[model samples]
Target chain A: MDNIAGHKSGLSWVTNISVVVLVVLWLIPTVGLFVSSFRERDQISVSGWWQAPFSVELTYRTRGDGEVRPVDGGYVMEGNIFDTGEVRSSFEGGASTVSAFGDRGVAPAEYPAGTVAEIGDGETLQVNADGTYIYTSVEEPGNRGPRVYFEAETPPQFTLDNYRNVLTADGMDRAFINTLTVTIPATVIPILIAAFAAYALAWMDFPGRGLLIALVVGLLVVPLQLALVPMLNLHQRLGIGQSFLGIWLAHTGFGLPLAVYLLRNYMVGLPRDIIESAKVDGATDFQLFVKIILPLSFPALAAFAIFQFLWTWNDLLVAKVFLPSDDASKVMTVKIADDLLGSRGGDWGILATAAFVSIAVPLVVFFTMQRFLVRGLLAGSVK
Target chain B: MAPRAGFVSLKGFYMPVIVQGLLTIVIGVGGCIGYFYLSNLLLDKVIFPAKGENAGRNINRANQIRPWLFLFPAIFALGLYLVYPVVGSFWRSLYGRSPSDWVGFDNYVQLAASNEFQQAFFNNLLWVIVVPAMATFLGLLVAQLTDKLSWGNIAKSLIFMPMAISFVGASLIWKFVYANDADIGLINAIRASLGFGNPIDVMQIPFWNNFFLMVILIWIQTGFAMVILSAALRGIPEETIEAAILDGANPWQLFFRIKVPQIMGTIVVVWTTITILVLKVFDIVYTMTGGNFGTEILPSYMMDFMFRDDGRATAVAFIIMIVVLPVMIWNIVQARKEMR
Candidate 1:
């Protein structure tokens, strides 16, 4: 009985352990992104993402110049770098001061000018001989701001600053709009063309119908890179090259083969009886397609739409190929990637935020457009 | 009402029949063929062109034209956008130029000899082999497993959620997973916490990084496979499973002998579908690593050439096209076989 009970407990424990393990494994990076996205740069450097959101053990030293003006009667000196408002609010009222203005965090016993600072207030603080001070003020108000005394536990406060810098300060705002301009038309144009082609391919019987489709399928294997020069040439001939229209056309051209293939597969699954009956009723293919087939193929259309939208949105290569290399026409993916890798690759904060921002639109798109993708249009077709 | 009317009015019937049904069918079929062969420009001209079929049925083929008239704008657009570029890509592949400084076979030879081209080709080969196989395998596995259960819909939905994530989003998500720093990426953090060495650069791991990139494609595509395969699996009649069971066929035998054979067509379709996807596998690699660190595939390499402002990009593009063409033919043939 003891052996059996132990085995059973172990089995359950193993299952529970796996579940916990999987959940943690999944959450580790997610939790990191959430934490790193919030923490300041210096904090991020000191602790791993997991150790973040916890009170970090940090030591700070405060200093005052007190060097230039050696008013012998009083202890006043002109500081080198710090003017008024040099100390943050954390230092505004806390009992902190520069202890021996040396370079290192673990400073030597003496500064260049042999100066020291101690706790004081706005009025009646007296500096004594030998770098010491007496803060004795009658009118000192109660310390109101964050206390700056050494070793104060500053609980992690997440801020909107990262998001702000990413959205506004990073020039992502223009890139965001530019990306949408490129992606929306790029996505929409292909779906529109592909839907019609899909319908025609699935329903309409024409000569080389097999061949036309084979051609599209053939085009699929022909990597977009293969077409870059030719398309650029055509774009030049058409004079739409390096324009938004050119990029959109490039995306649409590249995107359509898959779109047509998918939508055609989906359309062929619609009830042929409905289509035949509509044709029997003197409805033209267009009328039949517009009224019946398209409505029926919505699930597939939406799925393809979402797919195209995302592909185009995230595309940098084609945008670079067809669109002008000018800043105004550059899409978000290109802008974020090029900018970061060029000037600020090491700025992980800016990079992370920009990366997230670039993908934010597509993320929203997927969540909403996903449901239509769930329904299998062909479920009842073969039966 | 028309059932009785069909036999009568022979003179009225033959003329109306010849004019309306026969002519329209002929023109529709004719136009379809015309568009198919004559490249894009001619196809567009035939469909929409400057001339409208304004004449009455007696004067012109306007009656036949009326049925396919709605196809004009779309056909024109398709011709201009998709069809034109295909021809353009092929035509442009013939010449190497910064702008019409034509070097004929030079481009092809350059492409054939290029180290970058070879790398991209091999990488593409890897993508074509690995991505489709893994996607099909996982999708089939998920579909089969989920199809057996009662609360399968929820399980399937949970699995399918990744499909809803775009390639870029998915890459971002996994970037966090593979981040070199523990705080930034999950896998590294776990490794560090488990007392492993310092964090590993998963993306920078060459050769394997291709597979690492392929994993993202697999993740996104698995949901696609599961959805399609599950639908196919569901279509298998329950009686068949019951009959196999009654015949004393074990689970494996029943699955292989009965269920598997029935859905082999769907499986082929799924495989070929994914195979086509493998040929065009660009975004995940491009987005994740910029095709650097030994990850350059055909499309990414082509993009590199274009960005370098070199004519060689076109030649590379042509080689990629040649590589993909045979597979394209195979896919079409498979699809046709399925149709038959």
Candidate 2:
């Protein structure tokens, strides 16, 4: 009884703190990728995502590409260090002010910004806060531009270029559509087939029904890895090799055990009086299923649909084994794993954006229908 | 890519993929609806002739045959896709490259003798043992800790978010976390910030790297365990907890003694579910290290041999199936008991 009311004990504080810590620990990795996706490649390489909002120090070694022009007295080679356009995109908000500039490699930031430094060869290098540099030499500088080294403070930058690159340049757009093509039919066909089958199992009196149920329970854990070589060979012989149709059928087969199990369990529990009354009215089993059982079993149907959708959508091995490797047929998971992350492991921008794209759809489905999902998991797993 | 031999070309037709996709769906859904409607119509109107003088007998006959009619497609699909594959894999394991020449148990013998197979076998053993135990333990701890808090659901959802991510996506996320560079990766960035000069390549450390990869699955499956076990905990009878409170049981004693025992059945279910997942763990290792640096498990190893060596690949797959069979039977037995 003492535990019933809120006593405001020290345990409450502990629980609060522990929950905060747990949430942060869980959120860190995913949040890290989300933040990294917006950053430019060089910025992601130079600093951690946690330090993104702070001013970043970037070291650039840029050569003045243009000829040396005589401005006032001495010949001067004048250009901004961020003139390369690649460096300009790193400063997201605006041009970052140069904190320091140096003429030699030993000390790239030897001279402070807005200060003039004298060199031993009568060459002076003066840099402004905006990364614009002025170099004056008493003698005529060579045709080649001098290497101007500067350390500048750049504002944090974010862009959609990574998403652009993945969707257009890396073939993720086609993969997304291919995933949908595989997923829609796979999700739709199983519900109808399983629903009909489940109705029969739940209501009809048939010999070996219990044995068939047991067999399904056994098949639930049958690893689809065993299906790879044999099924591929089967598809090849049947002339359905590596087509969208083949993949849809593969997904349907793999998803059926759970679908039938869940729907049967749900349908078996429906009020028996309704089905008895329908049968008394001389309604056939098909009529009873369509008019009564199907509508009432919406929750179970929804639960199985989400499971199949997420399962088939997230599947990589099935698609890899059953579908052809043509650009037209690759799914997002296969493309992201095999083509993008495999080769461009160091490209965080593309990798993060691509990963997020693949994860986004199922996440939306999960959040929107989490109630049915939780119900399905409990019913499917628990007694 | 090599042009697939002996396959019919659907390329000459210039239909958009979206149109083709929609057409297939229409055909598939239309065919399913058509079959069900026509079959039922025939059963009621033509075959049994329910309106005749022998209506009772005809109805009985249709009822007796109706379940089979409904079950035919599912059975065919299950037989072709699942049961047939199991049998086919066994058959393929007995034959040579082309299946004409016999190689009975020769692939199995060679697999047992190979060093790589041993490495993958031991690594799989490590995963099967460690992932379920760790994930279940963490799930129970989190579920217990977060049960009474105001923000518990939100906290649970945060932990549960990884479940929606594909293994490939999760691998990429964790790879970023375990990135070798000191600047981009979170782990090495923290290390470098703390004055550790050299960054550790976490995926390259043999033996322990398997655990590192297992962490991803653990992270994903813990939320599932938490959601299920949390419900199971709530299902524990209130009188038992109240009685423990009256007996002056402390918090730890209350949880481990009263609560844990009550939900032990659920704990076993969660453990076995995760065990099944860990046995099939492939995509993470495949994407993260491609079985390099001693991170190979059973499935990834089987995939490596799939196109190159048929007999050995089927044998490896059969090995995984054998490993899974006992757990599968245990699951079915538990479910059957629940049914009654």
Candidate 3:
């Protein structure tokens, strides 16, 4: 044991290291997206969120104003402090300092009070700490604005407003509802149809049953992309193009092969005796299915449901083709893909949050139903 | 217990079954007649734009025939929505656009002759060959390595988490790692740091781009392979392994002789399963590079055809079917064999 431990621990180190490396490889980009999603766009441009925890420096211009005070030291101060909202998004908080503050647009170490520096604009500006500041109109000015700079403390942090923006985008909410509308029914219908087909194939005595089962399995290998254009053309000819029914049928057709494959395999493994005993008790096929087989096949049904649901929910192409993208039927997958895939699809935060949001349902589906995948419900039933 | 009274089945469940069949037939015939009458009314009404003597009864009284009138609409919708599309696609595959001009065998001929089509065909062939084999092999290796170990379940769970991620999500995730900027795309940053000149566009290279695209599918599929193969691996008898070890067999020998042959059927299932996936790959390619710079595969090509409103789209779709049909048959054969 000692020799084995001594010899193996060193070798085990490599395995551990590699595992860690692989884990990090998978996690880094996902983490990067998460961090980038919360940060301001300019902040994202300037530095990575990983370095955000350390000291951050921000330089800006501020003016002596907004005081309106006759203090013991100053005797006179007046102005309103104003912040253009653009500055707030970039400011880093914590261990932050103003490199310069001035009425003039210059990074200077110091500026004296009552120094009315001329900014390019006709307006003159003044500022004070209590955030009261004002700008005076210059003589003979036409369409010019005030200039003020104050390097305020910026902390390394961000908010979830990007996620809010993405979720609240006009198309996204509709698409989300649209995805649910398509996916939920699509997932349900196939499972219902396939369960009956599977039960018959598994338990019923009918001619050509094996061949039909074989054909369905064969259909499994046929890619849906092969079916797509023809199907669309079919929909067009049939005069059902770009409708809810079109997408539902598309999802059902695409989901069927796997659904039948999985369900039949599971049903065939069911205890034949229970089905036969039901027959002896005069339980009709429907009764047998509803009372006994359905409950037993729950695990398999659940697994397939999760599979179908996730796939349908996450589907973009079928939704794009069959469902009209014109407001009513644009699903989440199509909408999010549009948001992220073109133009500034490079925005890490919006993509991550949206990406995370899209998978949130799938994750729930998986967690809730994963037990069915491995649980040996039919284990003792047959043997 | 309720006994069947002569010809009547107990509780008459069979009555509904018979009624359903009869109703289907009635709806089928009634639907054609209804369509004809409706068109006649349409022709008379639209060209004439005049009120008929029975128009009031025709409109309101038609609604009063039966509450089951909704049932007819359901039937009509099914015919229009489902059966009509399949028949149309099949018919369209025969003729050119507009359903009138006969272009039998020409679309197929054009596809067969073109090098682009051949390249796509061969690329799909490569994907079918390579992805399943590599993913299944890697998965089997990982599954076996992780099996019987204390932490194997955790390893499997961690590896499988990517499968939970949507393909688009995954593509976006990888995008940053492969991003073009220094702060962006991790690979290039590391490459530059390591003194490599020029960042490579992994998704854009011809011939080699398929492999880069395949990597994501492999990454997602390997976890599936592991879980399934892990189950099949566990079904292997411990005595067989132990007996092999007792002899002059080593780890590699045990793996090849004992562990592998036992799980060969399952290996085929997983391989063929992923091969099916390779045939339908669209989102990854669509997201990563939009099937450009010589990265076009069959699915993406079909999408292009679809968007362009090309006759070639249906042709490509049909071609994809031809490629996939044999593999499907093989999966069924393997499945039957596995059942036995």
Most accurate candidate by lDDT: 2
Alpha-carbon runs more than 4 Å astray in model 2: A1-8, A64-74, A77-93, A102-122, A128-132, A142-145, B1-15
Expressed as tens digits, the lDDT of each residue in B128-233 for candidate 3 is 8888998898788777767655677777776766676778777777776666665556776788779988878777677888887777788788877888888888
What TM-score would you give candidate 1 relative to the actual structure?
0.73
What C-alpha lDDT values do all the predictions have? 0.61, 0.85, 0.63
lDDT of 2 by residue, B1-340 (tens): 2223223234432245566567767877788778888998889789998877999899889878888989999999999989998999998998876668798988899889989999999999999899999999989988998888778888888888788889998998897789998887778888998999999999998789899999989989999999999999999999999988888887878899999999999999899889888877689999999999988889999989878888888889999999999988887787778767
**Candidate achieving higher TM-score, 1 or 2:** 2
lDDT for B17 in candidate 2 is 55
Residue B9, candidate 1: Cα error in Å is: 70
TM-score of each: 0.73, 0.94, 0.76
- Two-chain DockQ for model 3: 0.14
lDDT of 2 by residue, A1-383 (tens): 43553344877788789878877888888898889989988788888888888768878776666558886667887777677444555555567778887878889999898888886678887888877777788888887666667888767888899999988788787788878878898899889989999998889889998888888888888988889889888888887777877888889899999999999989999999999999899787888998999999999999999999999999998988888876667899999888887688778899999999999999999888888988898888835
**DockQ per candidate, 2 decimals:** 0.15, 0.57, 0.14
Better of 1 and 3 by TM-score: 3
